[model samples]
Structure formats: C-alpha cells, structure tokens
Target: MSDHTINLNKAHFTISAPDIRKLPNDDGIEVAFAGRSNAGKSSALNTLTRQKSLARTSKTPGRTQLINVFEVEEGMRLVDLPGYGFAKVPLEMKKKWQKALGEYLEKRESLQGLVVLMDIRHPLKDLDHQLIEWAVESELPVLALLTKADKLSQGKASAQVLDVKKKLKPLGGDIKVYGFSSLKRTGFDQATQVISQWFSQNIENTEESDEVAE
Candidate 1:
C-alpha cells in the first residue's frame, strides 16, 4: 500500500490506559509496539506516523509506564506497550508488567501483530527473546526493528540485520527483522508496509470468516 493510503500522518493519540480493560473496545485490528526500555520504541512510532510527539520520547528509560493508544484511522489503533527491563524498576513491579504484557499479547483479540524494537548494539537480550516467544506462542506476526542503526556503519548495520534475522530463526514465528534508524528515517516505508499488511490481512480474514458463516 502507498504511504498516502495508510495516512499515518493523520494519526493522533487516543488515550493512555494503565490497564487493558480500560483500552478502547477491542472491536477492530490493532498493532502493538514492544521493546526493551530505551530501545527507541517511542521514536520509531513518532517517525512512522510522521508526528514528532505522537509517542513521547524520553531520555529516561521506562518513562512510558502505561499502555498508550493512538488512532491510525477509524477502527485501526497503534498500541505503545510499556517498555520492559529497566534496571531500577523494582522486581515486583517488573513482574507485574511482565504478566500484564504477556496477557495483553496472548489474549487481546484486536491485536493483529507486534513491532518489536531492539537496540542495534544490543539485539536479542533476554527479555527481547521472551517477547518474541510470546508472539510465537500467540501466533502473532512480528516485525522486529533493529533500532539505532545510524549508530553503526552501513556494513555493520547490514551485518547486524542478518545476524538478528539468523538469531530469530530459532523462535520461528511469522517474523521479519530489519535494520531501522529513527533518526535518519531509514526503513520507514518498509516498516509501515509490514504494519499495513497486517491490517489488510486481518480484514481479509474477517471477510472470509463472515463468508463461511453465511
């Protein structure tokens, strides 16, 4: 789909709900962005939508402590899940977040896919693997972005992309890993295309199910 078609530029914050029960009704397709704290998830969301403050970028890790929802269009939502794995977070609080995240990923009916972000220099940390595993178990599609690609040389970034892809093979779900730089806006189109495809696929599936029922 063309960039004009998604109209992500029109995207705007809908709400920030601390709990899943408080999120907008699970009536339509949505994609969740998940990553370790400080992995550039907010920066990526902002870049993809072409809205600087659509998702808040903070110098402090784990600043986004709630589930943030943005409207991509009617019935289409982009969810920014709270980042995990900040060192200063209490173990008890971290466990709560983890449980909540796992439940959200596994049980949220409207969640169509996930965008997993990882720092280019620190790809596939323990929590990152856990997130990917959750997606795999849920049978959700994933687009893994190696964020901060601009910090590395072109050759190094390309190699990291390949290495990340290779490492992800073991988890084995519908996953596509790409080198992405929020600063340079590199891989913006490609990342958005994957998200757009997830929306399209969900629509198609819903239609097919309706036809079968009829």
Candidate 2:
C-alpha cells in the first residue's frame, strides 16, 4: 500500500455513490478519475495518491459499479468512476456503467476536474473521445493522461504523448494531457503538478463559499 499521508496532509477512504445524484452534498471539491477498463486508471490513481488498493485495478473489465469516493483531505475528495465501453460485459451491465459514468460527469456539482486515463499504445479510443466530449459539453476541466508509459521506451513514450496531443487538438487546447506510468513511477511530478493546480482552484472556490456562509 502506498502511504500518501507522508506527502499528502490527509487521505482516507470515503464512500461510494450509485450515481452522482446520490453523492453526499456537504459541498467539498471533488477530483474524478475515469477511463476505459484496463487503461490503468486505478493503478495510476493508487500510485499518485499513494494508496495501494484504493480503486481496485484488475484484468476484469467493468469491475467498478459505483462512484467510489475518497476523502483526500477535510475539504477535498477523489471520485473513481466506472470504466466505459467494456464490450465483454453484458448489455445490462454496459448500460449501467454508461449510466453511472454519464450521470457522474453531468451531474456531480462538486466535481472540479477529471483525470482521463488511457493505455500508452491506445491513448484516445472512441470511449476516451466520448468522455472528453462529455467533459467539454459539461464545461469540466480535464487532465488527459496516457497510462502505462513504462511499457514504452523513452522515445516511444514521447511519441505517444505527441499522438495523444494530436488527437486532443480537435477537442480544444484548453485541456491538458500527459503520460503516466505507475510501475516506473514516471510522470509523478507532472501529474502532481496538475492535481496541485486543481487543488489551488478548489481552495479558492471553497474560500469563496465559506465567506458567503459567513
């Protein structure tokens, strides 16, 4: 297990939501992780947050059934969303994941940013593009990530990043993209910087909310 507390002031398992509508509304900032199954979303999350089994990664696709939330601090939470486009899954199940993912992305008010993970070789598939479209349509900030970068050589990793960026251009330049690897611990600092940027924005929003409450 990764001990995130060493660098992160606070991190803890929170709760799970069947849908965004069901998410607790105490008004905390939320950062969400979403991707296709086997894209290493969970692994990257666990690695970044230093939580070994936080999101539950497995070879089995569509394992996550709910929006798993983690309280990273008193005022912020991390949401692990169900993976989309698991062709091996049953129709009913595929529908469920789609619903869960859609509802969360569209309705989760506290959701401040999204971390979209993709395998290095397959950075932006159809599912990935749909998720990006959802974020853009919903006016959500997204940090697009290519996972499993270690599987590629350094030269290949750079190429993958370029490929991803090229695909993202149609989506707009407002979104940020990067490559990550849990095994090699590559892109940790870059990923951290992205999260920290969101944290600052979240803090600003929280402060404003607090002042209004006063």
Candidate 3:
C-alpha cells in the first residue's frame, strides 16, 4: 500500500528542552516540516491534512516550540518542527533551540524527508538557504513549498517559482517545489503526492527489523 492510501490521524506532542533527556523515538519514516517563523508552516500543514487545527497557526513567529510528532498513519509520522530564524527570542534560548533542532535533524535516523516551507513573496532568503544547506548536508531530500501564493499575481508567482528553482538547484537533485495557498486550498494534491511518494518509497526500502538491527 502507498502513503496516499494510508489513513492519517493525529498522534502526539512533545517538547524537548536542552536538558531533556531524550526526544521521541524515531521508529518509522518521519516526514518533517520546517520553515522560518510565521511563514505559513502551520497553515500549510492544516491545508495538506484537511484539518483546520491539526497544526496551530500563530501570528507571531516561533510559536511552535516543540518537536511535535503526528502519526500520519501506521508506518509513518509527520513531525512539525519549530521554525527557525526567529532572532528576537532571547540569546540563550536561541542557542538552545539551535542545538536541539540541529541535533534532531542531524541525528534522527527515521527522518525520511523534509518539507521546507518558504513564503512565496520572500523566497531564497538567508535563513532559507541555511536550512536548505542543512538538509543537503544530511543527505535528506527536501520538497520545497512556496506558501501563500494567493498574495501574488499569477505572473509574479510564476516568476517567483523560477527564482526559487534557481536557488534550489545547487542544494541537490530531485527537489520538488509548488506554489501553495492554504486558505484557498490550492496545491494540496501536489503536496500530498509529494508526501505519499516519499513515505511509500522509504517504507519499501528498509524493513522494521532492519531498522531495529541498525
């Protein structure tokens, strides 16, 4: 069976602090969403899953401060990670967030793919490049979503897509991107397809026993 066919449901929540002894267990292929704060990360998540409050939307950036894990189905998890690039937070807290998030992204073995959300009007910024670099360095495939496409005119959106493409080519091959608007329910199918393909292929590759053995 494919991920598209898999029945997705809510799983659980977690808040990992610097002193926290451990993060959640990475047992299955976990697809994560990461973006800068207030970049429509939560909205896009709600849009993709057809759940209004599946992820909490915040007017302020950096509100999601946890390694929130939602089990998409029996064999996979959808991880909503804390957004990056919120510098107004305290310096000490920033350091802790960086350490915690960076460690999770780097060390999580079941993390199969990353869905990087970028605001359509403001794509390819410094923070975006940094996270893209992290995904590439980890050898993880990224599916870039240019959210809030409704804000831009069609012509402008087309141009922005090209611009993002130019920036992503250097990261690695096979990166997928789409113009999405959570409010208007646009691009849901495309994003769902991306997740479906990612999880399905990953589930096929390594067995559960093999993962445990490793």
* Cα TM-score of candidate 2: 0.89
- For each candidate, how many residue pairs have backbone atoms clashing (under 3 Å)? 0, 0, 0
Candidate 1 Cα lDDT to native: 0.88
Q: Can you tell me which runs of candidate 1 are displaced by over 4 Å?
A: 1-4
Q: Candidate 1 lDDT, tens digit per residue, 1-214?
A: 2222566677899998777888899888899999999899999999999888899898888888888999988888899998998888888878777777777787789999999999999999998988888889889899999999999999999999999888889888899999999899888989989998887777777777888999
lDDT ranking from best candidate downward: 1, 2, 3
TM-score of each: 0.93, 0.89, 0.87
Question: What are the runs in model 3 whose C-alpha is more than 4 Å off?
Answer: 1-4, 9-21, 207-214
Backbone clash pairs for candidate 2 read none
Per-model root-mean-square deviation over C-alphas:
2.2, 4.1, 3.0
Candidate 2 local lDDT, 14-131, one digit each (tens): 7887777777784767888998877888888888877788778888877887888888777678788888877788899788878888877776678888899888888788889888
Model 2 ranges off by over 4 Å? 1-9, 209-214
- What lDDT does each candidate get? 0.88, 0.79, 0.78
State which candidate has the highest TM-score: 1
Query: How big is the positional error of residue 92 in model 1, measured in Å on the Cα after superposition?
Result: 4.0
